[model samples]
Target: MIASDARLAINPNDKVLPSFSHMADAIVRMATKPDRRSGDLLLWSDTFASLRRLFIGVGAGALVGLMVGLNTAIFPGLRAMSRSFLTFLSIIPPLTLLPILFIAFGVGETAKVMLIFIGTVFVISRDLHLYVLQLPKEQITKALTLGASDLAVTYRIVLPQIMPRLIETTRLTLGGAWLFLIAAEMISATEGLGYRIGLVRRYLAMDVIIPYVLWITLLGFLLDWLLRLAVARLYPWYRTGKE
Candidate 1:
């Protein structure tokens, strides 16, 4: 009855866009059915494959970005040396580097992960650098006056304050991360959300395509929610400071 009602809501001649019921049906079919390219089920395998790339790429990038931001903000000389280069990287369209990445790294998982990492790392790093610099110089002076070493001031005084900001930065960059992941997967991956979407596009598989796109969106939302939850739980003080 639900399916029939959904069909009635849409024009019978329309084949380009699937109704919500049709999309739900296609999602189930993809979830249960084995992929033609891979023996594993379509949605399950593709989702995880994309997620693995997302985690590795974003995880590594965030860690490095945090360090870059911290060190650059602490040391003016280092910031001067690399600031322009980092700015250049952040502004260049990461998608434009896809071909070069594929050529340099080949069409493997490495290339896909690198694409996401490169896409996000510079932006996150720069944002955090500016954020850290905004912090009062009095805090650092007090820490040094209290006999804190340079490293001690950085990790002890500054790191805790910035960790929450890192999470927020990661949340903001998640969309770009997905974009790079999808673009890389579409170009060469044998099995991924983007791979499947690109593969089925030739056949005009709106049912599969729509569901997969929605699934990506759902996954992104869940990730963002989780990050927000983590920030709230782990750094209540951060929010209190903001308030």
Candidate 2:
């Protein structure tokens, strides 16, 4: 017979780390219960606020990046003018600008939104520019041969095709977008997912921290899924071409 192991028979209360069951219970309780300190549900409200900033920041960035990329690809003059500046901007660590942004924007919603925008715009623009350059030159020549004006070629041809690529680029940059959003919120926000996590860190609240982190991950996954579904539904040609 094997010797009985005392260590393996330790009481639950004696354990230093929580069991898997305890963690699961913590997550569930967190979802259902109001915050002890505030007597309010912080999760939903923080999630909404973070999401609002995310949408505004990312939406504006995507639109601007799309325009910059499309024009840079079509016009050599704009490419020459903007390429070096964009490259320089992309290389700068965006987090390093957080203090400046807070100073300039006064720690308001604008600062948080602008952090995400400035972090993501150059990356999306550069990626889209590269994608645009890879598109066959023959398509442009064909349009011109058929007497399509520059505007017609751009809007009627290039824009539609690049829509899928723009969505794809946006999806890819979302991780970084979340990072920037959280960083901004952590630095200067009264209530947000990041702010809550930062607020609870002093107390070593793993229960709240873990759940919030998981919620952020779930939100990111959902956004990526929605973007993918949009590409499939709105631009079937892009998906078929990939396959």
Candidate 3:
């Protein structure tokens, strides 16, 4: 009977080990396997696409900066009037112009692009004007002494020296352009990250909304990174501050 009891106890102990082993196996599987759906992957890809758009926005910002920079450098007298007018316009919340833009340019690409352009130009121009005025007179004088024409002096001497500062100014203006785009899209956009966010919000889809916000943030960051890289490449000498 004692031997029978010993065998029965052993049988129960054997079953307990397998049970523990199965539990351990389940825990390991849970730890190693990722719980992601196909939707997650699609979301990631869409985020990347949005990031590309943000980079495009940065390019737009750069163009706007270039135009404003050229205007301020070439025509200092007009700077004040342009600056004041643009400042007034910018202060009027970007969304407020939606109706006007929609009426004039319609709820199309033109209006959206114009909104970004208008939002960025004045501030960038103001920064560029200040930087131009602060440039060393000796550089301008040297260019003139070397038989450089007015246009040549402005392009070769003035522009090259301030190119780094102009890039920095563009970087700053990008934020404003981004803000304007989001507002403009929210006002009247059929497609875009901003539009997607607005749609999700209307439905109270917090999950989708959160991911879209992450997408926008990540895209903005990537654009800023690309701009910095471009600046480093285009103005390598400027990095040392010896230029």
Candidate 4:
């Protein structure tokens, strides 16, 4: 009776209405079937925990990127110095620095955090410096004429205007940080997805390795999507071309 009613609602005389009703019935039957792995709550819990860690890592990266980017924009000389030093460091693979990091900081959380920070801060700072310098000259002139101090003008006018770009640079840096985490974890991690992957790789467990890679890739995608959503919400003025 419900199927007939739905068909009637769709079209009084359309022959396709019956086909639609059958499709709806099939969907209902599929929905009513019990999930075979209904008892695997532990699996779901572990998955959620892993996801939480990924989110935390991405958030930390974004915060570090934002601070570094802002510092670069405000202090061009510092940006130049950072660029030169970081460029030289980049020539040497981060994995090569692992031994030095371990010797200096030990195989601890500090070394891991520093590795992530080092991989991210330079690129974010450079992008931010370029974006800030590209701001309209007229905007700076107007702010100066209005008796605003250089710092005040930058903080109030310039920073607000370039916030969207800053958010974008942050998103980019967060992606880099994810890559860094894998390398950092490889150094001496006792735990973490990267460590798990390293352990599995020794035994040539392709099954475990594939799932770990997929999990991390999914996490990266989710973090990027969330950041994009945040940018749209916080800076509604930027207008994501979503008409």
Please name the candidate that would achieve the greatest TM-score relative to the true structure: 1
Clashing pairs in 2: none
What tens digits encode model 4's per-residue C-alpha lDDT throughout 1-243? Answer: 565568667786533324444545433432354436553232244345444444565556556655565656556686776756645554555556667887998987677776665665556556666777777888878889989887887678877877787677767766667676777666577666676667657866444555566667887888779878888899987765754
Per-model TM-score, in order, reads 0.92, 0.88, 0.70, 0.68
Off by over 4 Å in 4: 1-93, 239-243
Residue 45's lDDT within candidate 3 is 47
Model 4 clash pairs are: none
List the lowest-lDDT window of 10 residues for candidate 4.
Answer: 38-47
Misplaced by over 4 Å in model 2 are 1-16, 20-30, 34-39, 241-243
In what order do the candidates fall by lDDT, top score first?
Answer: 1, 2, 3, 4
lDDT of candidates 1 onward, in order: 0.90, 0.85, 0.64, 0.64
Estimate, for each residue in 111-206, the C-alpha lDDT of model 2 and write its tens digit.
Answer: 999989998899889888888889999999999999999889888989888999999999999999999999888888988899988987786666
Q: Write the per-residue lDDT of candidate 3 for residues 120-232, one digit (tens) a residue.
A: 65666667766787778888788789898878877777777777777777777777777777776677765566766676577554445554565577767776787788888
TM-score of structure candidate 1: 0.92
Give the TM-score ranking, best first: 1, 2, 3, 4
Compute the lDDT of residue 90 as modeled in candidate 2.
Answer: 79
